[model samples]
Target: MPVVGIIAEYNPLHNGHAHHLEHVRKLAADEGIVCVLSSNFVQRGEPALLSKWARTEMALAAGADLVLELPSAFACSSAEYFASGAVSILNSLGIIDCLSFGSEEGDIDVLKTAADILAFEDDDFREILKSELDKGLSFAVSRQNALKTVLTGKSGQNIEKAAEAIDQPNNILGIEYIKAIKRFNSNIEPVTIMRKGQGYKSLDRTSPFSSATAIRHHIRELPDLRAISNDPFLKSNMPEACLNILIKETESGRHPIFPEYYSDIILHSFRNMPAENIASLPYMEEGLENRLKRAAIESVSVDEMVSKVVTSRYPASRIKRIMFSMLTGMTAEFLDELKSNGYAQYIRVLGFNDTGRSLLSQMRKKASLPIIVKPAGYKKLDTLAKKLFEHEIRSTDAYVLGYRSPGQRIGGQEYTSSPIISVR
Candidate 1:
């Protein structure tokens, strides 16, 4: 089967996601659609509103043939590494024909041009980037300025437009996807689907294709989903099937998990974690861990904790990743070793349909990494792979602790859970 891979958070499946999937299906045609979705946490450095399993069901219902988990190491990380991890998994499968993503610009040529410049960062580019950083600009701003400076120096190119492209969220992610494809030297073609409706941070629900932020805000405004059936506006933002699944999950007290729900765990973990240990976390740098440690003792809430540590150079998202890494016991030493290895050791399947099964059958023959369709499958992995996967399992256990229903807070969901097999 010809398979197309998508890297997404799918925090909750909304109309924009459905629209993207429809375009992906059109691009794949008779091919299967495979997705590498964030598990428990998202790239935005927050817990997913819905569980991975529910999101998998939503993807399956929305025409995705297969769903795979992007481990927490990648799921809650910055865009570059997140794309790297997801693309690596797709490439390892060896069956994906293309990598599809939604982008505001929707132009592959422009994204590739920028990605090529970044992937091949020369001495001049590095110097420019260093100069920008020396000016005390944030990494994002520095990188954009450096890229724009470099692009403008090039002859006969639309430097102005190319420079502005990286400032947008989707375009930046698209560039990372392209860079990852190049890094792996994979054969998967890159495709960008034009994004619809309000911008990424917009909270407007008037549009049919509202942002995930908007959808979450809309859901949070209500006391309960008891009136969901009558809310035409809410239903219009998402697919009916996905909306139903969300309602059911919420009713069971499993939907809409916010970061604040797990603030106590994070706060306590931070307070107890020795100052020496904080330096060992991936991305913890320049005595920022000490700042975080101090904030942990001083702050009363997750928002305040992050706010206290956030600086121009270190954004809230970056702070969240560091905090989450600490919560999940992700160490700088371990992540550095993992980066040296430079490949996903295992593929953890989240869900599949008949077409996906066929794709999996083909994957078994072509894949370079171990394909795990169940939690018990972790036992068959090697020592290093097992250690890496244990982090994922621990993250799931942490995720369940935030569920609204105490009765549903059972752990070992990763160990006992089987992949969601969609009959569709």
Candidate 2:
């Protein structure tokens, strides 16, 4: 049987996610379900509604055979790096045969064609891209123009159809996934599952199925999700109720689920760091720093800060990635080191299932690095893992304060929850 890999952040393990998993398994039924997950921070600039460990339990319970953590560096990165990191780990494991993902359109061939063109930008394409960008067109529009100029020369009708198809949000990410697979030259086959329910970033509060952003906002306001979703994992949240669940959990000396520990640090960094320094943050391109600096002084909530800095041309998502990089200290230099390694040498086991034990045993025979399922304390780890884990805990601790007065020093590797779960 082949093993398939799914790279995801089940931020809250909602119903749409459950559908994605079911569809992926059906597409690659014979393959073992391996998922590389985001730990604390997500690609979006906000904290996860649930912790990685919690998310892991949710996924394994859903259907995944095994789950591993996508190191924090890659977890909170832009779409390009997020795809790179998750794809690299699956490639390194050398076990996956098919890679499956959810897309607005399940047209894998179009995505692959787009990926092929993106992999190598020609002179014509580059010139068109530059001209459009100089004219203040968004990168998406710039890319669409470049693609059209190149493809329309030969297949005008085909190019028109492809242009309309490729411009959607999910399709863009799917292309990135294909690009990452080619970049690694991995043996994994690629497939796309069509998305069901509310559209991406849809603000339709009326739909039981909403975007993760909407659900998160709803939780903050209502906390009670059972009335909202038929999702079992979310429905189980009782007594805790909506946003108060997070609030009460933090007050009870629990981790705030995401790397919430960095709120003050992020605030301080924004407050003190110069506009020049902010520009150095990852994905901070084309004078976006001035807006960020201004927002730092004027905005209060993280959401408010992002909104203040976002421009139609620059886009909020890119700005969020930049601030997230700053919050986590994932400097470009650190990214360079990770790039050199290709796959981070550490498999900081985020969460797993019944098959995880078998997979771990299999990995030991061929793997080059240590896969630590449980991180006990600071005393035992090497420099790199220790530093990463500590910062994660610090972010967790700092985040909990919004709800409680839990004052305790988190050691180098002192995670309140078990770092890994051999979920058998």
Best by lDDT: 1
TM-score of 2: 0.83
Q: Model 1, 33: alpha-carbon shift in Å?
A: 0.6
lDDT of 1 by residue, 1-424 (tens): 3578998887788888898899888877767999998988888888889999999989999999989999888888888888888998999998999988889888888899899989879999999999998887778789999999988856544455678799999999999999989988999999887898789989987788889998888777877667766677778998999998888898888767888988898999889888888888877777877899899999988999999988888888889988887777778887777667774779999999998999999999999999998788889999878887999988888889989989999988888888899995
Candidate 1 to truth, TM: 0.97
* TM-score, per-candidate, Cα-based: 0.97, 0.83
Any idea what lDDT model 1 has? 0.86
Alpha-carbon RMSD, each predicted model = 1.4, 4.4
Q: For each candidate, how many residue pairs have backbone atoms clashing (under 3 Å)?
A: 0, 6
Candidate 2: worst-modelled 10 consecutive residues by lDDT? 237-246
